[model samples]
Target: MLTRDEVFAVLQTVPDPEVPVISVVELGVVRDVDITPDGVTVTMTPTYSGCPAMREMEADVKAALLARGVRNVTVRMTLSPAWTTDWIGEEAREKLRRYGIAPPGRADQGGFVTLTRARPAVACPFCGSTDTVLQSEFGSTACKAIHSCRACGSPFDEFKAL
Candidate 1:
């Protein structure tokens, strides 16, 4: 029988398919773990409702747990609480920075909508410069934005705040 802690430990080894530098657990995708006599169930919340990586992430979790000798594995996704960038830990943010992707800043929780809001400058992950310009609102994925650093002339992705 696998303890809850042991299950989580195994999940920590399951890296995110999109962000290989960080585990799915580190990305705050795994919401809860339930162990039963019949099987183990993992509850997950996608970074966004339509995130394309959700299926891959669920498959990886199942495969990882199965490889660990678990007989049955179930992945349940919930969208009620909706994933937030604020769920990302400080250590994970540093890892993203080291991986050349600018980590997201605090998410805006203001309920009001504003069309004239100026976009904040994203710091360059490679050169640590605030003199970065947004090359495109969309990056390799919808969850990230493309930015170019004026200081080092490096193009990098910024994990957009949800």
Candidate 2:
């Protein structure tokens, strides 16, 4: 039987399909790991309710565990608490920056909806400058936005805070 830590170690090897540089664990999606004599269950939360990469992520998690000799593996997803960028650790944030994607800032917890919320200026990942312009509200994915850095004249993606 595999221990919880062992399962997590295996899970850490599974990278997110969208963000290949970071593992699902580093993305803060792997919420819990439960082990039993019969099988292993992994609980996860998607970055959003309708994230397209979630199916791939779940498959990767199960495949990773199965490769480790586990006969049966289960991936359970929960949306009760939802997913937040705040779950992302500082180290993972730095990894995102190194990958040329601006890490998300603190998530807005105002609990009120506004038509137009003032978005903070995101620092450039390449030149480390705050002189960045929002090129588009949508990027390659829904959770990201497109931006251009004035200092480096480079276009990059900014992971939106949720």
Candidate 3:
């Protein structure tokens, strides 16, 4: 039987289907891991409700553990407390920038209240410029917003802070 840490190590190898550059661990979706006599149990919080990639992620998690010789894995999806961009690590932020996607800005004390008004300027991932414009409220993903950098004349996706 594998330990919780060992199972986590295996899970860290499972990458997100939409963002192949980062793993589910780096994405901050894996909430808890438990190793018991029956098998391993993984608790996950989706980035958002009705996220299309969630089922694929569940399968990937199961496949990853099974490939390591641990069978009977259970993946539980939790919604309480919700998921916020604040959960993303610093390393993951830099990786997102390098991958041509602007990471989410810091969440304010009032949470998403700012979203009701004008959105804060999103820095360009290509040129690191704050002079960017929102091209569309929707991006490739529902969780992201599309923006164009005036300085670099490049279009990029900003991971909306939630």
Candidate 4:
């Protein structure tokens, strides 16, 4: 019985386990939300197949929906194609930067391809400098790990590889 806007309002609060600043929508994880007569069925795609945070993310989504008085919730995981940071909208990108994790940077292509977080030139989210490198492939959480910005001489956790 809930409207799509109502659903998205609730979902906005469901933060990404790895990147707190960005919600599942910003990360392009929660692909669809269905308000059916039977119940609510949420379709989602993981950033990657091997993403360890998948279970937690699904649980969080269900819990969040339920908290909004939605019943018969179903969180379905799908990997039809894949996830890309480009799906993360500009507003979400700003939030990511403010969260202190660098946003997507230079790639081999002329930005024609999806913005790739993997092996990207992530600038220092804090200093806004491009001199940054991956400190660790894994981060504090199962979904993200350590990174160091050479320009600002600070270390940060980038979104973990999906």
Candidate maximizing lDDT: 1
- Ordered list by lDDT, greatest first: 1, 2, 3, 4
| Clash count list over all predictions | 0, 0, 0, 6
lDDT of 4: 0.75
Looking at candidate 3, the ten consecutive residues that score lowest on lDDT are 107-116
lDDT of 4 by residue, 1-162 (tens): 678888877888889887777788777888888898877988999877888888989999889988888878999888985676557777887887787865554223433333344465666779977687777665676545577888878898665333
TM-score of 1: 0.95
TM-score of 4: 0.79
**Candidate 2 TM-score, C-alpha based:** 0.96
Of the pair 1 and 4, which is ahead by lDDT? 1
In order, what is each prediction's RMSD in angstroms?
1.6, 1.3, 1.3, 4.0
Q: Please, what are the lDDT tens digits per residue for candidate 2 over residues 1-162?
A: 789999999988998898888899999999999898989999999998899999999999989998989999999999968788888899989999999999999888855323268889999999899999999888999888999999989999998888
Each model's TM-score, in the order given?
Answer: 0.95, 0.96, 0.95, 0.79
Model 1 RMSD in Å is 1.6
Winner by TM-score between candidate 3 and candidate 2? 2
Model 1: CA > 4 A from native = 110-116
Consecutive 10-residue window with the lowest summed lDDT within model 1: 110-119
lDDT (Cα, 0-100) at 86 in candidate 4: 59
lDDT of 1: 0.92
**Best candidate, TM-score-wise?**
2
Please, what are the lDDT tens digits per residue for candidate 1 over residues 86-117?
88999999999999999998888954323345
For candidate 4, the per-residue lDDT at 106 reads 25
Residue 111 lDDT, candidate 3, scale 0-100: 51
